[model samples]
Target: MRPTAAAFRPLTHRITTGAAITHVHNSSVPQARGILTLKDHVYFAKATARGRGRSGAVKSNGDCPLELKMATPKIIGGTGDGHNPEQLFGMGYASCFLGSLQLMASRMDKKHVAEDAKVHPNVFLGHPDDPTLEGFGLRVEITVEGCEDDDVITAAHEYCAYSRMLKHGANVRVTKA
Candidate 1:
């Protein structure tokens, strides 16, 4: 019988705005506002083979296909402007820091293998020789391939909630937006 705090604050703001309204922004007006609007009707098909009409097909709403492309994506922040939101918050903090370093390498059994985790973060929008972001920095390059050396020096002294809120700092409590 414990349900105060505005009844769980609308389920934690619907799981953080439902993971940011089901993120789908690869451009083109936010990808046609999350697909299905070229006047609908399956978005044109049935006219191929020497007919010149089938060079576009990454649009769906039922089987998960609203434009998403990321082959080995690890660009967290901007290196040359490929996208923003700090590269989606550095790819969600480099996949939650490699799933918490593979759950601490399976409860200390070792053989760690988070083969690929990157966060080339940078948001110094007004520094780095007059960038502009004002302040933001990240340079976490974790590629611990086949693990060893005491599980990569014991997950490099673990404890990484986004690197402890970027080390020793966190008190976000805004009210009345």
Candidate 2:
């Protein structure tokens, strides 16, 4: 069974209580019960899918870059003409990680070193080793170009939200609509 949000806390978080106000966007707001998070975001987006499974299409609710036509790979009995979820995940991870790496390098006084950093992410889908879970599982390997310093990389990993989520796990829930 999936653990409830109230019961599951990240290993890195220390729970806080009470109406402690935080300044965000020049406004004071009460801290959430479990932990303070980005309830208010600088950017927001929504996507919806249409049509059959992997053969479907996905588009953003508002202005978006592309209206994707998804297709399963030939190895899985698909036409393989279009994109897949793995590709999307890799793109998001790479972009986010690259931004983090660049920021890290700048903070470390090595701005020139990672000015052209590129994050390459390899996302692999395979059967889960855990028996209770479903068949599909994902693993990722990220390589950063233009900077190879372990300290910079380590700092970036810590600062990056995507990196933290991959390493520490996340709370997700699905409900029937």
Candidate 3:
């Protein structure tokens, strides 16, 4: 049987590492329910960044020494020493969207939709000269491969968290390839 929220006790489990700690709250309250299994539910990733705007570096709180250097392309007069924010965003979104796609496919009994699937998220940064407009904007094109039908891909896209988050706020297009 599936474990409901009422079956669990209301407690917060704190996992700490070095200077970072993440609190996982297990609630029995019926109203505060989450769409996840009992054991594996909440997930978190923490990272800190320092330096100038496009020339900064970020490191995760994990034991492994994971660091990233931020830089813009030389076309924009940047040194292009490392990846920029747009690339990182694309990577994160694509990976997350692929997970969502796989989950949705499994749930819908369409396992082949996600088998050996690949997601390509193309993120573009644009700056308008209009003073009234914001500093910059992003346009994303998410292309999915190994999916048989566009309808299935669209359904998965609709269920993706990144797609939901950027649906109304950003200009995003999803295509099946």
Candidate 4:
């Protein structure tokens, strides 16, 4: 069964109170939550990367028409001439969240407000300040313009796949081919 905004209930109340928000905002690996698998994927996007570290290049597969040269951001000690992974992630999340917000809004009969809503997403890179954790980490912040309804925002947070993955870690398997 698809989860509704009520599935994330109490979150709506929490948003209003500004206390005890459940979503994790840190770079630490997420704790396991519920699991649901779809019988079929709606779509699959593939991309390839070559070169070294942040100085590489990424190109989308035949399915997508995208190509970008990766560059380490100045904040992380490199020339910020090209795009970085964070920008891509931020853009993806913003797009997904905006859709989620609009979806929930339409369900709540507030589609008019969401029709012009804008999502501001920020992906920050840092140490994540965990002694046990190594390497770089990411922090995300999203702001939705034109919608202040706690229910819509909370529902969108719950609905967004990116947010869900960050909150409840996805099953990731790395195997050499």
Q: Which numbered prediction scores highest in lDDT against the true structure?
A: 4
Write the residue-wise lDDT of candidate 2 on 60-118 in tens digits. 76665568899998988999988998899889878887788789889999988778777
Q: How many pairs of residues collide in each model?
A: 4, 0, 0, 0
Regions more than 4 Å wrong, model 2: 1-39, 63-65, 173-177
Q: Cα lDDT of all candidates, in order?
A: 0.34, 0.63, 0.61, 0.69
lDDT leaderboard ranking: 4, 2, 3, 1
Q: Give TM per candidate.
A: 0.22, 0.73, 0.66, 0.79
Per-residue lDDT of model 4, residues 80-174, tens digit only: 88899989998998899899999999999988868888888777776746577677677666767777777788778878887776654555667
Model 4 residue 30 distance off true place after TM-score fit, in angstroms = 9.6
> Model 2: which ten-residue window has the lowest total lDDT?
2-11
- Cα TM-score of candidate 3: 0.66
Which segments of model 1 are wrong by more than 4 Å? 1-82, 86-88, 112-159, 163-169, 173-177
TM-score sort, best first: 4, 2, 3, 1
- Which scores better on TM-score, 2 or 4? 4
State how far residue 83 of model 3 sits from its true place (Å).
Answer: 1.1
